[model samples]
Target: MSVLAAVVRELGSEPVVEEFADPAPEDAADVVAAALNPVDVAVLNGQIPFRRLAPPFVAGLEGVARLRDGRHRYFFAPEPPFGSFAESVPLAGAEMTAAVPAGLDPVVAAALGVSGLAAHLSLTATGGLVAGEDVLILGADGQVGRVAVQLARAFGAGRVIGVVRDGDSRRVPLALGADAAVSSTDVDGLAERLRAEAPDGVDLILDLVWGPVVGPSLAVARQNARVVQVGNSGGPDATLNAPSFRNRGVRFLPHSNFLFSPEDRAAGFEELAARAARGEVEVEVERVPLAGAPEAHRRLVAGAAKRKLVLTTTSGTD
Candidate 1:
């Protein structure tokens, strides 16, 4: 009953390919694809606060897997000893699992799961983003930010602007649905550019890279604008301008995937999966073998990947 898995055999050690007892059907489901994310990388480094599993535990938080009826399903927070990085993993629950929409690739579903849900909920549920309002996405070149840029448009935003690392990184967001993109490195020019792009001020700000951008973004925010902090990829801390935020009457809403209820998660996935199936949203994915997970983790930590990295059961050689 042994199956291949990417196991963290020691603290601070790279995940290695190993054999572990296969999860029984009643307790686990077969995984088809496991998508790597910032949190997964954090878990590996013992950075996730709630993650306390020691060495010998499987690695990965969520993935797309096949259900008993042979349909693809997405699940999150698998049992401690087994995770999504293996051929099979313990199921979180029926509430945490959703059928992949027809025509959506399992790899894409796995890649989009938590990130997509974050974007959808940030704009609609949390930000109260409505039609005819301007939406700004910081770190829009990254996975969830890119998805948020597209979702902002699909959700009927009058304008969608993205803040990327530089001019070179601007095209992807623009092509994905953003009306314009500003460079994050252009610190002095950020406020000007934001004003130029969103003359009336941005109604909602999806702060994916919160640190450096928060201050400048707040300067261009419309009165009563809602800034939803979704990720801290740039850095966990930010020096904010209190007066600007207070004068604008802006609201800062911090978001975590854990804040979403089971019903909300399922609904988010259904909406995003349908969008993917209709080709309205697409994720550029790089396939890697489960054995290459260590290398994948290294590259991801270094921020070297230009596309979504997905690990599958296939041999690493392609």
Candidate 2:
């Protein structure tokens, strides 16, 4: 048997493919899934926050692979070569991790950890989210955004407003449970519709596309509305009116933690598993042989892949 992977072919280029030996069934993981998360880059860039696992390491936070035995299968992360966008990271020791088993495809399963877990924390655990509260999911097509839309539905949100880029069909986010989907694609019309939907202002703003994109959206929130900062794709900095927030009692709550308590991680796994089992969430995926692991990084960086890129490893196979 052989393992497939995606690899970084060159700097600022797309990831390519290569195959390697497969893991014996005895060594293959039974639990199959790699949960993606938003981890900050520490040493280099992408996988910096995960430097604790290994400095100069492959940056992906999650993925899912077929497993055998009781072993778990996930994207193999190795210590990347410092100061160079080189090949695959080292895979010496058994560092494979397992994620919750749900009805989710391997892509969705790989996503269960970071993005899905983030959704669980932002909407349920911290916010005490309940039914009838409206949610505004900005950048709903992205990984975290998609999960957030689904989470809003599970928590019984009264309405979900999906703000998406131009040329994107609203049906995808709508299928994820958004009541109304708007386009940020038309910047001119975005503000009016955003304000119109929130007669009292949106109860919660999941700003994955923060920065200037946040301006018009913030202006429309009602008193005591909460804004959760998840991503800064728009830019790193933005101005906010302190007096306005104080006067309206608007709250800014950024999700600040990645290391879920073991209990919390366990709970999230259970929750996502249930969702996958029910076929509530769908994860689109693109898979490659183990040798292409580097190409996976390249493509991921190039913004060329819409689905989660999966790298198959030979760690556990016949």
Candidate 3:
């Protein structure tokens, strides 16, 4: 049997839709919706040192799939060569999958898998967010940042402030439940802008971009506040003044979704899914057909995809 999938013929190359041998029934699950994530791009370009895959393989890291029992679930990290972008993916049993909420849309479920889990876990587990506490989300225009804004509000944040690189992108987070949005276009004035919105300082900081902005974002951290470092989209290195953070006793925590146990990840995703179903949490997403993965990949690499992109199969739409 053969199945259609987005295959990367070589590292650093665009994915091409083509037929590939189907996985055996014992190892395969019917794919519904697959999320295109930055990690997927990293893995594709061989940028992830820990996970290096040879080319001519299916392209996607996580997605929503149908189990044999007719229940839909979100699965991640399919064994190499078999990815969620395909109609049938070789998922390794129930260990790598989580049950999706009954009423959640498949595309939403897919979007909520990787990015949702990151935002949900980083805020609650790593950042130790408390109800009525002020929260700051860096890189608020990105997928995770956008979701984090909504999750923070839904989770009972007192004030949610989002920081974007461009002034025009500030509205992206504002519409997603952030109380205020600040542009980091001028790094020198970022701290002032953040303070104007969060005069008392933020209780929890979700730092998605670690660069010059990190220093300013940290300046407004309340004493004992936790800064959860999720990504470094802005740059790989950040300069910080030791005394600034030391005097406030602010805690910096590094976060990786892979570090969470499967159970913890599932619980976080389930909670987000529940909230999304009830309209309490929402992520801006663009739905693309499975065959359009190549174009999606191009947009993702070129940084043109402003919203979360989910590859939907025919069955996924229904």
Candidate 4:
């Protein structure tokens, strides 16, 4: 059977919506909503050397789908060549699928999977966030960073500071529960600004943009602080001052969603979904039809999209 999907015909090219063969019968599920993430762009541009896929494959790795029995599930890591940016996709097994919480919007469920898991797990499981401790979130204007700001507050952080790229972007994190929002635009003065906001030093740091901003962020870390590094949106490389880093005894923990176990990922997603359903946590999302995948990819690559984008099918609305 042929189904509509966004197909990547080549590396560095935008995904084109077209009719593609349906997922194999044994593993097939009808897609409801699929999220568009930076990782998907990275894979499309061949930035991830190890996870390369040949052209003519579906475009998304995860989404909300309907099982054969009409039960809704949020599935991850769909079998390659048949991804979630389609009418139907192939699941690896039951292990890759989790039940979406009751009354959760399918688009929000899909949006919360990759970005939400990264934010929630980075703080709890990876950064070892403790109640009443001070937290610092770099790149807090991004999807994962936005969620981190709210999660930090929800998890009982005494103070939460978010560092954003633009001066105007400060309002985003501030509105989302960050105690203070600092701008990284003035790289030279970042340390001074952060120190002013967090005089006692931060206990946990979620570093999402690891460029020149990292040095200033580390400068404000209290002794024995845990720094969870999740992304390099600012840049791939960073230079750390040897003495400042060592003297503070900062524990640099690198985080990736792929490193987490299936059970942990599922639990994290469920918790985030529930919180979103209860209105305790919120993420700015832009809904687009599946056929708009090409334009969405272009916006993502150009860094013009500030909100999380979720592609919805007719099934998703029902």
Q: Estimate each model's TM-score.
A: 0.94, 0.75, 0.96, 0.95
lDDT of 4 by residue, 1-318 (tens): 899999989988889999998877887888999998888988887787645888888888789998778767999867677788899887765347778877877788898888898999999889888899999999999899999998999889999999999899999999998889999999999999998999889999899999899988887899999889999989999998878878878888999987988998898888888888888788778999998989988898788887888899988776
In candidate 1, which residue pairs clash?
A: none
Q: State residue 151's C-alpha deviation in candidate 1, in Å.
A: 0.6
Report the lDDT tens digits of candidate 2 across residue range 253-313.
Answer: 8773354464565466567656765876656666554455555555655667776655444
What CA RMSD would you report for each candidate?
2.2, 5.2, 1.5, 1.7
State residue 163's C-alpha deviation in candidate 1, in Å.
Answer: 0.8
Distance (Å) between predicted and true CA of 243, model 1?
A: 2.3
Best by TM-score: 3
* Whole-model lDDT per candidate: 0.84, 0.58, 0.88, 0.87
lDDT of 1 at 305: 94
Backbone clash tally (model 2): 45
lDDT of candidate 3? 0.88
